[model samples]
Target: MARAPKTPPIPPDARAVLGRFETRGPVRSRPMFGGHGVWCDDRFVAIVFRGVLYLKVDGETRPLFEAAGCSPFRMSADRPSRLAFYTLPAGVNAGSDDLEPWLDRALDAAST
Candidate 1:
């Protein structure tokens, strides 16, 4: 019997986007589609794709993301697949060190 090839591990740069969660709890970054699935404990909280970190959101906080000019994550579907996650704004990405609030929001949505 032949053994299957083992999948390559995710690169350090690709997974660096999830470093913030290390201190909070155990964070797992597994490859998903073209991105990585970020999980906090047992809940899916965020995703990192092409250097963009998207956080989970619910109906209540969706408007906030919109107001911040952050777009919801879209995937392939029969129509359009709008996921419950949104990208952080450019300003937030431009040297803004605080990500706790965003992480909090993601955890809240994932918890529910």
Candidate 2:
């Protein structure tokens, strides 16, 4: 029998990241994959892993993320599995409304 992998604690910065989505309504975070999974109004919308933020993407939004130079989330070098979530671009402004557009897209992706 194998023991279950230990669940990683939520990163400290997860709070700040969650703060950015507050206006989206009832946003929250839970420990996952050595970071946190972000939810808005009970729907998973994004992830905060290894100190980086990633938003959910779908077929329609994938090209947009790619065009923005955002890369998909990879578990690790040893485990190269990729997820649909893409990293938040460096140009996004956390302190301003610049993140709204991206967050809106992520929320839309989560809905569908």
Candidate 3:
């Protein structure tokens, strides 16, 4: 049997995370497994799932996020899932104080 469809409404906390997304293009958010995927233009730049915001990770940047105690994103709503995105450190909220530089790195990674 097939599973039910998921609604695409953006969550409030997810919206706040994107408020400081620092993008010039149109921003889009869609729900996925109780979290959110944030897109700028056509690029998949960020993810907010399970009440935690995650940034896109690449070869070099992956270590940084890890060093900061961030782990890869995983979802098991219907089944087990994992993605290239890494959870932003627990202390880094939508305010993005120390989160900005990390997000910038993520943006750079996504661009490349």
Candidate 4:
């Protein structure tokens, strides 16, 4: 059997963004499909795939992403598409400012 791919180290900016949620608990890291799944209170909030962060939020957060013009991850050409994950746009990747709200949404979704 093939081993699950290991996730890369958390980026400095991403670590800073996660620090804001320290009250929630230390972020848990797990390997997932050549990426990392970050969790709070044992719930998945975001994923780092190929050095890009993707927030996991449900339908209610769709408008926020739409307004930001963020796009959903297209995992592959032949698989059924998934919509609960949104990619951070190019220019916004390195800062905690653009990521906090989305992180909040993902945490909210994960909590309840």
Best by TM-score: 2
Ranking by lDDT: 2, 3, 1, 4
**What residue runs in model 4 are displaced by over 4 Å at the alpha carbon?**
1-6, 77-80, 89-98
Q: State the TM-score for model 1.
A: 0.74
lDDT for position 51 in model 2? 73
Q: Candidate 1 regions off by >4 Å?
A: 1-17, 76-79, 94-98
Superposed Cα deviation of residue 27, candidate 1 (Å): 0.4
Q: Which residue pairs collide in model 4, if any? A: none
Report the lDDT tens digits of candidate 2 across residue range 1-112. Answer: 9996665655555456567778778987887867778899887998877777789998898898899899788778666555679977766756655677788888899889
Clashes of each: 0, 0, 0, 0
lDDT of 1: 0.72
Which is the winner by TM-score between candidate 2 and candidate 3? 2
| 3-109 per-residue lDDT for model 4 (tens digits) | 86556787877666666666777778777777777888788887766666777767787677767887765566567446477775556644546655666787886
Model 2 misplacement above 4 A: 1-14
TM-score result, candidate 3: 0.75
Per-residue lDDT over 1-112 for candidate 1, one digit per residue giving the tens place of the 0 to 100 score: 9985554554564356456666667988787767678898778988766656788899877787788888777764345456688987656642357556776777788888
Residue 49 in model 4: shift from native, Å? 0.5
Query: Could you tell me the C-alpha RMSD of candidate 2 in Å?
Result: 2.9
lDDT of every model, 2 decimals: 0.72, 0.78, 0.75, 0.70
The positional error of residue 31 in candidate 1, measured at the CA in angstroms, is 1.4
Clashing pairs in 3: none
Task: Give Cα distance to truth, residue 67, candidate 2, Å.
Answer: 0.2
RMSD, one per candidate, in order: 3.8, 2.9, 3.3, 2.9
> Which scores higher on lDDT, 2 or 4?
2
